[model samples]
Target chain A: MTGNTAPSQADARRTVISVDAMGGDAGPAVVVAGIAKSASKNPDIGFLLHGPAEELEPLVARRKTLKGRVEIRDARDVVTMEDKPSQVMRNGKGTSMWSALESVRSGEADGVVSCGNTGALMALSMLRLRKLPGVNRPAIAILWPSRNPQGFNVMLDVGADVRADAEDLLQYALMGTSYIRNSMDLPCPRVGLLNVGTEEHKGRAELKEAYALISQNAEKANFEFVGFVEGSDIPGDIADVIVTDGFTGNVAIKTGEGTASLLRSAIREAFEYSILSRLAALLAYTSLSRLAKRIDPRRVNGGVFLGLNGTVVKSHGGADATGVSAAVKLAFLLAEQGFAEKLAARVASAVELAQDDATSADADAPGDSETGSTN
Target chain B: MTGNTAPSQADARRTVISVDAMGGDAGPAVVVAGIAKSASKNPDIGFLLHGPAEELEPLVARRKTLKGRVEIRDARDVVTMEDKPSQVMRNGKGTSMWSALESVRSGEADGVVSCGNTGALMALSMLRLRKLPGVNRPAIAILWPSRNPQGFNVMLDVGADVRADAEDLLQYALMGTSYIRNSMDLPCPRVGLLNVGTEEHKGRAELKEAYALISQNAEKANFEFVGFVEGSDIPGDIADVIVTDGFTGNVAIKTGEGTASLLRSAIREAFEYSILSRLAALLAYTSLSRLAKRIDPRRVNGGVFLGLNGTVVKSHGGADATGVSAAVKLAFLLAEQGFAEKLAARVASAVELAQDDATSADADAPGDSETGSTN
Candidate 1:
């Protein structure tokens, strides 16, 4: 613990990530192997693996690269995939998910990673870590592969909450912008409110109000408001950050994932249909693999829980070693850059400005009850 | 005049589709060519072409197949794509879209087909044809290519209205069921309410109520209620009919289309990246084309306006001859089977049953205003 015997200041400040080793579709073995891969790749990375000691100790001991880099924290309970958020909130005290979040809450880990139930994890994180100051509703920001120069677009409220009013959308815009700026290092990220149509007059009344709010505050928030964008724009480079209600975003996420999965299977089916196709597939195997890697969900396996006091990355529940390692790498980058602190400060100031704008609008249009019902 | 020289009794009952041959992106040429293709393929099909006779005469004259099969109605006006629905409602007189809908209203045509503005087309159809009895909100139903045994699934409210209460969703279910049963020939189509998740207690409050209402009337409606379905189910075979609010449905449609388009281009790009890839692409050309045909949007190119007294199919504004032919083929099927009349009767009976259930629920739980607040 003393600084005198520390390897170096940089090594002393090495980012430690809390990982929930239990509860993923694949057992804790994959989690250990994933961490081992990350540790071997990045010497500065350290992990606080949370799970049953008896189960994780041997797995951790088996990996030489993960031996000195990993620390095991014992936790007996596990949150299954079927566990409800309400059930987890009521009695998930000794679960690895709870213990992992606790490590982040206690500042022992810069960020936490888990492949457990999303609803339960979000609920536990919200209850434990608490929302950052001035954050009305916490959002789950995900990096979607896109045609952007940055290779991905940030989308939020993917399932944090089902409803996002105009205010909530504005916060999502701000939060998504912060996440993209920090994670992707994109200055002045372009933000768009996801709607059915690109036209300002189309979509729900709340979207119109959100468009106005985002446009009016884009300058102050240090991001370019791309006005409104359709669903296709989510994967396009038209917007660096795509914001929407949790309901639409969640469905879009699943739909996009499902579509990619379906098409991949279809391509494979096409390749195996006949001997000629099989031969052609072999000839085109290298290009196909490159294309596959470009669209592989495992390469970008983390969904960062934004608006929280500390960063928490949710790895896919069925993530293998590669997927888990991708999530770990994401966590490492965010933790190394102190993304949570920067995002918190950005959101705190931006939210204050947004509140002022709301106050002024209320004073300007006191009789407009429709505007009053924006929240 | 029609029955005097008819080749047979079936020809005497020829299904006439009113065509708005103006204002589409490709102009009347595509419309004329599309109908010509349909007319050549189906001898029982007839067309009432609405547009400037001066412009139409030349285009129609070129297609010998359309000579006796098509009837040009002299209309000088055209409905531009940029025209708003409200604007069209006030002063759409003499317009091709208005004239086309009028043909259906006057029983001159079995169904109306237009490649003009969707908003304008829907407005004219709603105004001229009016909603069927007991129908609160009309919806637009489109056939989405899926992994179903039928190769397509019916998804309604693609962009009819931005909002849908629990009752509206139930109506969409009924109308969608009627449309699918008649069109796809499925006796008991599986209908699902689209939501953020498939879980019973998830999503918005309206969705929860919709789940209950839909479940309560599944047997009466003659369809299986598959509870909630996610966006993936739109293209999957899990649900034959996916019901959703217009906002979500429209976004999901566009997202799916956009994702498909992006991936298509990505595949092409991947193939042309190098000489080897280009050679492989050439070798795999046949299989690739087959896969492309499977996902071609043109194969199923019509969006039928449901819950109307008369059938109306809105072709894509940029439809080519193939797309237009597909839409005309759909209209012919609907008109030949008298789908509008059957759907109206089914909706009326279903709505009555739903109302009876609502009235009894109101009597039982008088204090539950949330259920009553549905639309």
Candidate 2:
């Protein structure tokens, strides 16, 4: 494990994370620094760093903590922020991002982390890792800072695919619950369906259908169903996991981020407006820093790809060393818990239960008027 | 003008705003106080306050500014917050909310303001005053605190309808631009179509069509079209008007609000963390208050209903005196500017232009291959 000769089966305690060294806005130096930070904190972690060896070798050599724990995989190509998902899928095989995923694909690494183009990362992930059994759409789930006792709430389908049907949303719920149970150790998390209003007769036709479907499967799935939740509930204590289609979830999270960014700048501007305030800011520096740490986006930087055959964490493209380190930490935790296998098993059983429920309903009443209308 | 006897044509200087006094959660007293605040600020404003006369008479009698400027219109019933929009439309004729809208419908008032259930208010508004000619669905537009020089950016379809097609989004751009021009005094507002990404090929099918349609109509409509914008650009300086379907728009705004609220409370908690911080809070009071004033939701409480025959301002149901006053001020300003009629004319001409363009396109290329794919 210390030598990093690709952690053997005997050194199962060492969690090897394959990282795309060339994907981030910051260069491979930052990626090396991030892994070094993780290595310094956790002695059981190792890395398979991917990039052009000539460029990454110096960066890795500079980090003392990463000396014996890192193995560099040379790949000449790099995927930029401008690359499209379609283009990446067709021509990205030569890139470091592809090489990094290959390490996980071949079971050389427990998980993969990349601060690359989100679209490209998700596309390559789905193409290489494939979807789990009975899972139609794989979702990207992020932990939002919240008022909950856990300090965060899970939101899914942030931008994986813009559209999610009723069945797809139900699957997100199951996968989200499994992720939360494994990651946060919540055995029976409260799940809420994101909607315009909490009423029984609110939102789009698909949401109504999703409501009935998720509700019917809640008890069998071992989770409590909080029927409908508004956008405000994303950071609220009302639910542990909030589910929605990718488009709405993406917009909501971005809007929340933008608003928080705006307010933070405003707070700084206020403290700088007058001499009295400037003095006050100096006096309150320690308290303000604590508050900042609590809401810092860098602390919760990873977006976990759910329902995939292997675990892949997407770090923000513009992430710095701290952001990248947080993502690596998340990936390591998931990999250590064997999250991918557990999620796959959870979704497979849920699909079986759903088919059984449909069969029982058909046998009991062929013309069951209780079935949700497509409209 | 000062007496408010339902001002005649000769007394056109008086701008009468119909108020639904019974709809607010705080009751008619707060409504009276709110109108009094508006009356004290503007001399030419008047109100037709609708509620039970016995309950409203004493409240109006206590305010010197509202004495002669306010006229009470007795309506026996109130539209409760829990009532369904459908139920209110059928049995709300006797409610003060209906009477308030009737004043605008009969041209006795220039605009209407109500602190009631939003769905019921919108439903009764469409049923009473009807949609403007050539308008398909009416939208609710609200001003958001932003990085713009104007201090705010407009976002529409906040919750008026859960669905909006490509054509509906085009209308939102047209109407939103008009509202900004009349309210914010921006002659050529920059409009951006909200989507998951700024790229042309991103987002749902309707958004792509909307992007093309909005781009095509920009120059003719005298507004600068800034292609596609993400949710972050709603509060960003990149766009003055951000357009999207109601479901997405509603979720984005609420998420922003919730995030802001969470951060504000966190700020308060941070200041209360230590003795030094408590002293700093006292010293930074004025500066913090200034920042609070700039981002306070009460100052921008009203959500203006667009594309209607008459302007309707929906205040928060739980608005206090200050919140109600802000709504009243917005209604007064729009009423004085004759926003409804001007908007109707603008929309009418835009529809004609769209039709003419469609006809010309059909003639120019009988087998045009440039049409958007419905898939």
Q: Model 1: per-residue lDDT, tens digit, A342-364?
A: 87777767755656666775533
Deviation from native of the Cα of residue B33 in model 2, angstroms: 2.1
TM-score of 1: 0.91
Per-residue lDDT of model 2, residues A1-375, tens digit only:
112355444356799999999878888888888888998999898899898988888888888877778888888899998889999999998899999999899999999999988999999999999989899999999999888889899999899999999999999999898888877867789999999888888899999999999998786678899999999999988999999999999999999999998898898898898888888778778877888887788999999999898999999887888998999999999988888888877787776676767678542344333221111
True lDDT of residue B61, candidate 1: 84
| Residue pairs with clashing backbones, model 2 | none
Q: What is the DockQ of candidate 1?
A: 0.52
lDDT of 2 by residue, B1-375 (tens): 112345333346788899999878889999999998988998888888898888988899899877668778989899988899999999999999999999999988889999998999999999999999899999999999889999899999999999999999999999999899888868889999988888888999999898888988787778899999988899899999999999999999988988888898898898898888888778777877887887788999999999999989999888898999999999988977888888887887776676667778552343322221110
Give the lowest summed-lDDT range of ten residues in model 1 chain A. A1-10
lDDT (Cα, 0-100) at A90 in candidate 2: 99
State how far residue B29 of model 2 sits from its true place (Å): 2.4
